[model samples]
Target chain A: MPVYNARIIVTLRSSILDPEGTAIEHALHELTYTSCTNVRVGKYITMNVEAESEENAREILDQACRKLLANQVMEDYSYTLEETEREPA
Target chain B: MPVYNARIIVTLRSSILDPEGTAIEHALHELTYTSCTNVRVGKYITMNVEAESEENAREILDQACRKLLANQVMEDYSYTLEETEREPA
Candidate 1:
């Protein structure tokens, strides 16, 4: 079986207000990082999967992202998948 | 002034337990993505910074990550910075 590593980024839709983001922006200003703006926060997920092929890996990850990793209603997600060698025990 | 965009990824240290990650992994299994394992979740932050130079931009972002974006004791963070064209009005 081929092992694949997938990195997924899930972010809120632009129209939705992000309270966490707002709080971080305020904290940054208080810390004198005034040059920073439009700060948005999201989720980063890294997972490893054992699959038969690259396409199979992608399909599995896409399904995972849609079904569990992200909320499709208010969040958007993108991911990158790459093959990796299995780790030695 | 130059403007730079930074993407920051902050992940919990391996020594720390990630309940979110465990929950996600269980969800995937229930959803039949049984091959997927070692799922970890973290934070993804995007911000724009206006600065005098590339180094200045990096310094500001580094400070932002340290002071606001991540908890240094339990999380580790890394970022990439790129120059982006200003958004049109």
Candidate 2:
């Protein structure tokens, strides 16, 4: 089976509070960066899936996102897929 | 302060076990996708940071990643910085 790499981005909706992000923003000011402003936080994921075609890859990816990769309630996710020349780690 | 959007990706090193990824991979085969193979999971975070320049943004982002975005023991992180024409949410 061919291997495909998927990069998934998950982020909290704009309305939610990000305590960590806020703290980091404050830390920047302490670091002497007065220009620093609002900061929001999120996550980045990379995964490899086996599939014969892009459509198949998409199908597999959708399953992965729905079942495990994303939490649909507070965070929203989007993914990009690419074929890999080397085998997945 | 100018607003910039930073996309952060944090993943466990290749040697670590990912239970959620494994479960999702298994579910793919259950969904009739036998071709699916190794799947790794990680987080994709999108954040808005206020900074005057890419260099300044990077300085702030490094602090953010070290302080909050990533767990140093198990995860490694990388980020991309981009300017947003619209105000951050």
Candidate 3:
């Protein structure tokens, strides 16, 4: 089976409040980078998926995102896939 | 000031133990996604930066990443910038 490196970016819906991002904004302001604003934070995940084909790899990745990596009700996720020769750590 | 949207991804160094990732791996395994492995989790952040020029926007973003967005000793971060019409919330 071929191995695929899946990089997923999970972001909260714009309507949701991102307190951590707001906190980071204040921290940046305190650090004198007041020009930085509207700071929203989310999740970036990378995983290795072993599958029989590229299409199979994508299927597994999508399922993983929906089942565990993201909360579909309040968050959305996007991913990029690449072929890799690595396995799970 | 021109506003730029900065999207960043922060990931722990490979040498660092990502307990969160490990936990997710177990969850995936439980869900019968045994093919997915080496699951590493990270952060995705998006912010607006007001600067005088593209160069200035990049500079502020770099500073934010170094000082607040990522832990230099344990994590690494990278970003992409795009001009936007949004402001702080």
Candidate 4:
């Protein structure tokens, strides 16, 4: 079985108000950190899973996102999966 | 000035309801991804900053978390900073 690494990102829909992001930006200005901008709040989920193939992993991950991971009405999600690194002998 | 990389994680305070995480868990079960459990939703923010010292970076990050990045009533946050990686010749 091949081990797959997945990075899942979930963010509030554009229509939603992200008080968290807004607050962080304000604090940055107060600290004299002017270079930071466009702060957004979202989830970054890293998962390692065993799967027979990439297609199978994608199928399973999609199901997870739609059913358990993201809310259709208020949140949007995207994910990327890569094969696990192998150690050199 | 040294460049610092910060990873900010924001989670819903225990008292808050996380429908988003709940939904993701439910979806995972349906997709036959049984190994995953205790799924939670949070933000992972990556920032590259130029700071004179670690203390200064911490102060700014803290201010950002309080004023803009997190909701005190419902959210909590933690951050870690490491010096940026240098390119190898």
Best by TM-score: 1
lDDT tens digits by residue: candidate 4, A1-86: 67677778878887888787677667777777775554557786656656788888788778777776677788888888898863
lDDT of the structure predicted as candidate 4? 0.73
Give one digit per residue, the lDDT tens place, for model 2 in B4-62: 88877788877788887787678767876666577667766666767678888898778
Clashing pairs for predicted structure model 3, backbone only: none
**lDDT of each candidate versus the true structure:** 0.90, 0.74, 0.89, 0.73
What's the C-alpha lDDT at position A35 in model 3?
A: 85
lDDT of 3 by residue, A1-89 (tens): 78888899999999999999999889899999988888898999998888999999888888888988889999999999999875457
Off by over 4 Å in 4: A1-32, A35-42, A45-89, B85-89
**For residues B1-89, could you state the per-residue lDDT of candidate 3 as single tens digits?**
77988899899999999999999999999999999898999999998888899899988888888988889999999999998875467
For every candidate in turn, the CA RMSD to the true structure comes to 1.4, 4.0, 2.6, 8.0
CAPRI rating of model 2: acceptable
Lowest summed lDDT across 10 adjacent residues in model 4 chain B is found at B34-43
Residue B15 accuracy (lDDT) in model 4: 80
Superposition error at A8 for model 3 (Å): 0.5
Taken in order, the candidates have interface RMSDs of 0.6, 3.3, 0.8, 3.5
Positional deviation of B80 in candidate 4, in angstroms? 0.9
List the candidates ranked by lDDT, beginning with the highest.
1, 3, 2, 4
Error of 1 at B10 (Å): 0.4
What's the residue-level lDDT of B3 in candidate 1?
A: 81
Q: What DockQ does model 3 achieve?
A: 0.86
> What residue pairs are clashing in model 4?
A23-B67, A23-B68, A24-B68, A24-B69, A67-B27, A68-B23, A68-B24, A68-B27, A69-B24
Interface RMSD of predicted model 3: 0.8
DockQ of candidate 2 relative to the true structure: 0.44
